[model samples]
Every structure is written in structure tokens, then in C-alpha cells.
Target: MNPLYQIFVDPFVQMAGAPDLFAQTIWEGFVGGMLYALIALGYVLIFKASGVFNFAQGIMMVFAALTLVGLHEMGVHAYIALLLTLGVMYLLAVGVERAVLRPLVNQPDIILFMATFGLTYLLIGAGELVFGGNPKTMIAKELGLPSGGIDFNILGGLVSLQRIDIAAAVIASILVAGLAAFFQYTRVGRALRAVADDHQAALSVGISLNEIWVVVWFAAGVVALATGVMWGARSNVSFALQIVALKALPVLILGGFTSVPGAIVGGLVVGIGEKLGEFYWGPLLGGGIESWLAYVIALAFLLFRPHGLFGEKIIERI
Candidate 1:
């Protein structure tokens, strides 16, 4: 009856004896992880185009969800409302390009980062003013999304799984795959990569930096829409949900800022690691340790591998 053994060893032993619970835990992790990657990808899109980190991605998710709900309330059918939302995002992108990126071309990285912070607050104010700062139920069934449960019997026990979560996993996987392929194979994707490498170089080659920024930001808007819908489908759409998007920071840390596959792998690692850690090792530190476990992992990773699990290190010679 060692207290140390009881805290760590016994819990894992208990987990070993419960296969269904383990599967359920893993399922939860995968779903949460994918959502993190989705948000991180939004950041990646912005960073790739402008070489600046965007802090407003979380609010973009909130704004996208709010727009969908607002459109739905205004008598637009879900499909048309979604299309309209895309248009809204598209307009927002174009406006940002014309007003922000065009003016800030060749600005310092810190200035661009500050600009994104301003954009974040602008979005928050806009979303609150427009959406009323209330949590709204997701248009799950109305949007033709599925809802049900799966039953698994293991170790003489039962585990229930949500069908919506399954759909989220598949959709997330397809999204990541499509994005990877697009970036790897398409002309626009190559343009995006070139832009990421060097804005001046791309511009020298007759590439329009403003145009690429607009396109990339619009693409991020599309991602925000998709992420918002799935997220809203799981819970009420609100500013609070935007807070969850902050989890992408840790994912970014774990996966490296510039690596797409790193985002996915890092998200999954953080998601699963935090969940498992909370369940097994968290109690030893009291309880409810899930709130900041990802950060702790990120800090540890930073100490050991500052570039992140998949990030590349660059040496700049002055």
C-alpha cells in the first residue's frame, strides 16, 4: 500500500483492467485534438502569408459560428446561410487585404503581430455587438448532422460513443489530408509556400503579396467556418467556446509553428497526453488538472526541444 504507487501505479492498473474506458478516453482525445489542429491551421494560414502570428484566430471561430447562427435566425436556410457566411468571410478577407495588409506591407514582424491583435479585438467587439454575446445552441440536426451513440462492451463493461464525434474525426482527417495535398500539389499552394518563404522574393517574381494574403486569409475563413460548425454542433456557440481555441497555442508549441503535419501530430499528442495525464496522474496534484496540462507539456518541450516536436530551426547570419 505505497502512497506513491497508489497515486500512479494503481490508476494505470485500473485503466488496464478497463479497456472500454481506455477506448472512450482515446476517442475524446482524438476529437479534442483535431479541433485544436483546426484552430492552429488557421494561424498557420495567416503566418504563412504574412510571416506574422495571428492571435485572432479564436475569435474568428466565434465570429464564424455567430455569423452562421445569425444568418440562420434571419430566415436563411442552413445551406444558403453557410454560403453567405463564406461570402462574409471572403469580404472580410478582401477588406483586410485592402486596408491592412496593403498598408502594412514590409512592416516589422512585431508590427504585424500587433495588427492581428487589433484585428482580434475588432472581431470580438463586432461579434458581441452583432451576436449579442449569448451562447446559442448549435444547429446540429438542422444542419443535417448526425447524433447518436455507439455501445462498446469490453472488460465486462460498456462504453458509449457519440456518432457526431465520429463524424468530426472523419471530417477533420479529410480536411487535413486535403490541405496537405493542396499545399503539396496545387499552383496556389505553391504560391502560398513561396510567399511563406519570402514576401519580397515572391513579389519580385511578379507574385502579388496582397492577392496571396487575401486568398490565404479567405482560405482561413473557410477553415474557421468549418471549425465553427463542428464546434457549435458539439456545444453552444459562444465566446466561451472561443477560449477553447486558445488550446491551439499549446498545439502550436508542440507541433512547431510552420509544420502542418506537426500541427496534427502535436494536437493529437497534447490532446491525448493531457487527457491521459488528467485521468491517471492528475489526482496526485489534487484534481481538475486538465485546465493547464497542455501548457505544462509545452513548457517541458520548450525546455528540451525549443523548436517544438516537428519544427525546424533556422540560423540567420547577420
Candidate 2:
């Protein structure tokens, strides 16, 4: 085959020839994208409410998961461990508000960003000291998350789906929907948006900045816990999962840092685009395309639409 033809034409032909594989790939991408959106949602929650990009959100997911597993290892029931984990995250939010954020109020954005970096290391060291630096299993069975795979025959081929992935999709969808409704319909949520829009304006109107900061951070922690549970069940609960969580950066860039629904759409684009690229073009590029394809797509979006698909453009007058 000619090089150009093989590069472009052959992949489409292969997709047509194997429709089942194409469908299966799409399903897998959707599941993976949902997980990425879950992680990105953590970032969005904090950025929207506090106007600070949280660098520690990824590590928070690992720490939350480790806390749950650590508690369970200490003989706590799974559900109890979950509740305790939430409590721990709540305490963490309070601690951050007191020790990190409160003192730094009115500081430059870079100062707050750097503060989260310190918080990330603090959590890592504490997690290591408390949970030990070993990978642990997520108590999925005890937590009542389903296991096993379902197979479907279509277009003369078999496509297998994992029950856990389906659950993750459903749970993530509910979370995004619930959060959207909360932000749209609730008074507190409106307050949060008010703060996100203008801190001074919100305070002038009687919105408590301190209280709102605590609420957003706690909400981000809740999101981290959910992301940790789903990702941990799919793989081992380990600090290495933080690396995967970093993919949310590209998701954020594609969706816009402040847009909630943008995270979902961006994640789906990254997820589906990468899977299709790797499956079709990997052999052409000598494989390993899955790892970098997302960044490439993000770079393209940056060049064309810097504010992202759903992000509102900011204009300033000098």
C-alpha cells in the first residue's frame, strides 16, 4: 500500500470492515472519558468558587482513596470507612481554610497556587507515614460495586463490557447532573457562582467568602473521593493513580477551566479521539499513541479556541 493511502485510507477501511470493534472502542472510550470528567470536575469546583487553580486535587483523590483503604484495613466496615473518609476530607477542607487559605486571602493567584503545591506534598508525606507506601486493593465487593463483564454479539463480533465501568458512567452522570442542578437552582450554589464571578461584589452583597471557600473545597474533596473509588476499583489503589488524574489538565484545557459541562464534553472528545487514533494510527506511528494523543488534541484546541469550547471569553479594558 502507498504510504499516504495506508496512513489515511486504510484505517477507515478497517473500521468499516470491523464495525463491532469500532463500537467496542467507542464504548471503552466513553467509560474512560467519564472517569476523566469526574477528575476534572474536582478542579472545576475549586476554580469556580475560589478562583484558584488547585494543583493538589489529583493527590487529594489518592489521599482520599488511601484513607478509605487504610481505615478498612484497620477493621472499619466499608460503608463506615467511606463515611469516615468524607469526615477526613471535611477536616482537610477546614484545615486548608484555616492554615492555608485564610492567611493567604487577598494574595496573588500565584501565591494560592503555590500553597496547593505545598498541600500536595504535605498530604503525600502524611499518607505515606500513615498508610505506608504500598499499593492496596479497593474494597469494591464490600462496597457493593458490581463485578463481571457482559458480552454482546453485534455485526458478527463480540464486544465485552464491564459492569463496574457501567456503574462508573451512571454514577458520574448523576454527580454532574446533581452538581449542575445545585449550581443552577440552589441559593448556596448561586452564592458560589456570585463569588466566582466577583469576590468583592459577592462580599458587598453579604455572601460570606470564608464560608463559601470552605464549601467549595469540601465539594471538591467529595468529588475526589468519588473519583478515587471508581478509579481504585478499576485498578489498585496507589499514589501512581495521581499521574492518571493529571490527564484532567488536558480535559480542563479542552473544556475550559470554569465550565462544568465543558469537562464532560472535553473528556469525551479526548477519550474517543485518542482511542480511535491509537487503534487506527498506532501501527502507523509504531504504537504508544494513546499516551500523547490527548495532549496533541489539547494543543490543537489551544491554538484554535484558547478559551475552550464552552468557556466564556474574558475581555479587559485598559
Candidate 3:
């Protein structure tokens, strides 16, 4: 086959030939994309409320998962461990607000960004010390997450759907909706939006910056815990999972750093595009395309839509 024809025509022809396979691939991509969106949502929550990029969010997810698994290992019930984990995350949010954010209230954005970097390393060290540097099981069975999958026969092929993935997608969707409602209808949410727009202005209006920081950080922590649970169930709970969580960066770039809906759409696009690219174009270029394909797509989006698909444009007058 000619290179041009193979590159342009072959993949679609293969998709048409194996419709079931195509559907299966899409399903898998959707599941993966939902997880990515969950992680990206953590970033969005903090950035929107605090104007900080939150370099520690990925590690926060890993730490939250490790904390849950560690607590379960200590003979706590799975559900109990989950609640305790949320409490721990809340305490962490408070600690971060007091120790890290409060003192630096009027600092430059770069300083806040660097503070999160220190927080990341601090969490990594503390997690390793407390939980030990070992991979642990996610306790999915104890948590009541599904274990088996359903299979469908179509176009002379089989398409399998995991119950856990479906559950994860549903749970993520509900969480996102709940968060949207919270941000739109709650008093704290309005205060957060005001702070996001201008910290000094929010303070001038009698909103307590310390209280808002703690609230947003705690909100981000809740998001991290959910992402950790779902992703941990899919794979072993380990520090290495933080690397996978970093893929949210590209999702943020594609969707926009501060847009909640953008995270969902960006994640789906990255997820589906990468899976399709690897399945169809990997052999043509060589395998291992899945790893870098997302960054490439993000780079393209950066070139075309720098503010992202859902991001607001910033205009300044000199």
C-alpha cells in the first residue's frame, strides 16, 4: 500500500470493516477520558477559586489513594476508611491554607506555584513515611465497585464493557454535576468566584480570604479523593499513578485551565483521539503512539486555540 493511501484511507477502511472493534475502542477511550477529566477537574477547581495552577494536585490524588489503602490495611472498614480519607484531605486543606497560602496571600503567582511544588514534595515524603513506599490494592471489592464485565456480539466481533468503568463514568458525571450546582447556587461558591476574579476586591467586600482558600483547597481535595478511588480501582494504588495523573495537564491545556465543562470535553477528545490514533495509526508510524499522541494533540490545540476550547480571552489595555 502507498504511504499516503495507507495513512489516509486504511485506518477508516479498517474501522468500517470492524465496526464492533471500533465501538469497543471508543468505549474504552470514553472510560479513560472520564478518568482524565476527573483529574483535570481537580486542577480546575483550585485554579478557578485560587488562581493557582496547583502543581501538587497530581500528587494529592496519589496521596489520597495511598491514605485510603493504608487506612484499610490498618483494619478500618472500607467505607470508614473512605470517610477518614475525606477528613484527612480536609485537614490537609486547612493545613495548606494556614501554613502555605495564608502567609503568601499577596505574593506573586509564581511564588504560589512554587509553594505547591514544595507541597508536592512534602506530601510525597510524608506519604512514603506513613504508608511505606509499596504498591497496595485498591480494595474495590470491599468498596462495592463492580468486578466483571458484559460482552456484546456485533458485526461478527465482541465488545466488552467493564462494570467498574461504567460505574466510574456515572460517579464522575454525578460529581461534576454536583460541583456545578454548588458553584452556581451556594453562597460560598459566589464568594469563591468573586475571589477568583480579584482577591483584593473580594476582601474589600468582606469575604474572608483565609476561609475561601480553605474551602477551595478542600473542594480540590475532595476531587482528588474521587479520582484516586476510581483510578486506583482500575490499577494498583502506587506512587507511579501520579505520572498517569499528570496527563491532566494536557487536558487542562485543551479544555482551558479554569473551565469545568472544558475539562470534560477536552478529556473526551484526548481520550478518544489517542485511542483511535494508536489503534489505527500506530502500526503505520510504529507502536508507542499512545504515550505521546495526547501531547501532540494538545500542542495543536495550543497553536490554534491558546485559551483553550472553553477558556475566556484576556484583553489588557496599555
For candidate 3, write residues 7-62 as lDDT tens digits: 99999999999999999999999999999999999999899888888999999999
lDDT of 1: 0.86
Query: Model-by-model lDDT, in order?
Result: 0.86, 0.92, 0.92
Give the poorly placed runs of model 2, Cα more than 4 Å off.
none
State the lDDT of candidate 1 residue by residue for 6-122, as single tens digits. Answer: 875898897888877887888788888888888888887787678778887888888998999998998999889889999999999998888777898778989988888898899
- Of 1 and 3, the candidate ranking higher by TM-score: 3
Instruction: Provide TM-scores for the models.
Output: 0.96, 0.98, 0.97
CA RMSD for every model?
1.4, 1.1, 1.1
Considering only N, C-alpha and C atoms within 3 Å, which residue pairs clash in candidate 1?
none
Judging by lDDT, tell me the better candidate of 1 and 2.
2
